[model samples]
Target chain A: MVVGLAAGFAPAAVADAYLDMIEAETEKIAGPLPTVVDGEAGAESEEDAGFQEFLAYLKEESLGSYTFFEKLTPAQRSEVFERHKQGASLEQIREIIMERFLKR
Target chain B: MRNCVGMILGLACLMQPVWAEEVKVGEADSEFAVKLTEDTDYLHVVHQGKSVKVQRVQDPNYELRGYFAKTGRKCPPFCLQPMHADPAVTSVGEVEVLEFMENELRDGQGFLIDARTPSWFQKGTIPGSINMPFTVLSKGEDDPEMAAALEQFGAKRRGPVGAMTKTLEGWGLFEAEQKTAAWDFTEAKQLLLWCNGPACGQSPRAVRGLLEVGYPADKLFYYRGGMQIWQLFGLTTVIPDA
Candidate 1:
């Protein structure tokens, strides 16, 4: 009877041991889970919000040139916003962006 | 009063021919009158919210000049492209393009795409054609710009696909020709894409890039002759803002 009980328990114990070994191997391979700091996450979201606002402004005021402006790199887009802040009209911004593309 | 009368007579004489000499397509008195075809007199399309009449120069002496008129270009980049970008993508000529403008384009069922870079496109493009640069289209579907372009071309994102769905697609149980893992092109617009000319690779590359992303082959048409041939035949071109 003792041998019979031992046999059933032995398979269950072996299975648990195999599972434990697999979990350990997987953890070793994957390393630590990345922790997202609150500050970094907040900064990314803030930048995204700013970009979305700029896109909305472009869509509303410069619908004709919006597609071209949307293709600008982040740096280029910043320059365009700076120009706008400095009193450049949408048409002037478009021409400036177009000149840059034409030079390319 | 005598001097005023004489001035009025001179002005009338100048205006007479201006009103009388207005020549309609296929009705020019000169033997050099140009016609698109025996049936087609001219094509009319809308460009930048204005109606544009596309017709050849009536002057028999008119010659193609400037960049398009050149016979040769450096080979490596400007080498002639094949008749077909892909076997499945139909190649079209000027007549078919005109017909497309009259029917599909006018009906909003198709798009005439100028697939050159902005530098080339800004110079001028075929009337009624909108610029969708090859660079933008060839960036792969995963790119945000490319995804936006695909959306503009009437493709919808399918989001992520499950393994079971993928297996069904692989087994031909799903309609796969108009779909990719990323995009559903079931309602994609018919695109007639052109670039510089027969030697231009821009449109062909754009077509191939679209095909790689599983855009329906039937929806893509390549105009291999492009701007060069379009000009050789004296079709109309329009500068975007000019």
Candidate 2:
């Protein structure tokens, strides 16, 4: 089931680098969360209070222009929440965003 | 032995043969500048990803018809004028508008104003335009300088909050302000506001801003053909406050 979904939403080469960085940054904040459920779960929840703090700092610096939730599509946003529950790899989730939202 | 053989066979895989070719962004004929037929109300965007089928319920403004997995239209051609649920504005021809400009400017039909940032204004502007940056409108109400400027323009200050916020946010901020502010007719008969054209919406935003500030719609005309149009016509423009 996961592979089928991933196949549909594969990121392009150009966008994958940024996705990887976002994944790492989110993980560094979230700490040893579940890898299987990476995407939004690792990025959104307070599981990584430190990362949330970091995001707040970035948001403030950018004058609230950088919106994480708004940036992602409905499908990608929900996947992030699911990744948190599954403790998936941040990489996997980021891939979904690149493939599903930005690439298209 | 049979199960072991099957497992071994499953592990073996081969790369699938496929053609590698670079996909183009837009259709050839569609990209060219053409006078769109009035009867033609729809433009189909055929692309690899979500195919955007946009129907022109109104000129310039398109409505998304569907997003098909295969041959579905995700967005319309050239990212043109924004697709609005209510398309108040219409598209204009790049070529045919030359006479309109000469007539309007010659007859004093309108005043041209460049409402970009001071820095952008300094770079270049439409010939015979005064630079009144839109930043003044975006500033806080308590900003004494902006308040004073607004007063000079004869704008009413009803609320303590920034006066232009209602106008600004309504028109999608940056693009709307540029479009609406171009309509300020303090000194002229009609206002032509422009930043970039077609792909850019700053001028449209400014125009919408002016409309919010109680400017008459008839007195307002957006040069959808902005600086790009000016530059293309071999017409010279002044650089910034020059």
| Candidate whose TM-score is highest | 1
TM-score of each: 0.59, 0.33
lDDT for each residue of candidate 1 in B1-242, tens digit (9 for 90 to 100): 22335777867665654445565655443333687776655655656544455667666676776656678766654688999999999999999999988777766688999998775665667867898987788777899999998999889999789999899889876787678878988888999999878888889988998888888999999999998888887777776763
Computed on C-alpha atoms, the DockQ of candidate 2 is 0.01
CA deviation > 4 Å runs, candidate 2: A1-104, B1-80, B83-109, B137-188
- lDDT tens readout by residue for model 2, A1-104: 99987776674442355334323322222222111112232123334345454345435654322355447544334434444334434455445445444433
Error of 1 at B207 (Å): 0.9
| Candidate 1, DockQ score (0 to 1) | 0.01
**Cα lDDT listed for each candidate:** 0.72, 0.42
Using lDDT, give the best candidate's number.
Answer: 1
In model 1 chain A, the worst 10-residue window by lDDT is A29-38
**True contacts preserved, each candidate?**
0.00, 0.00
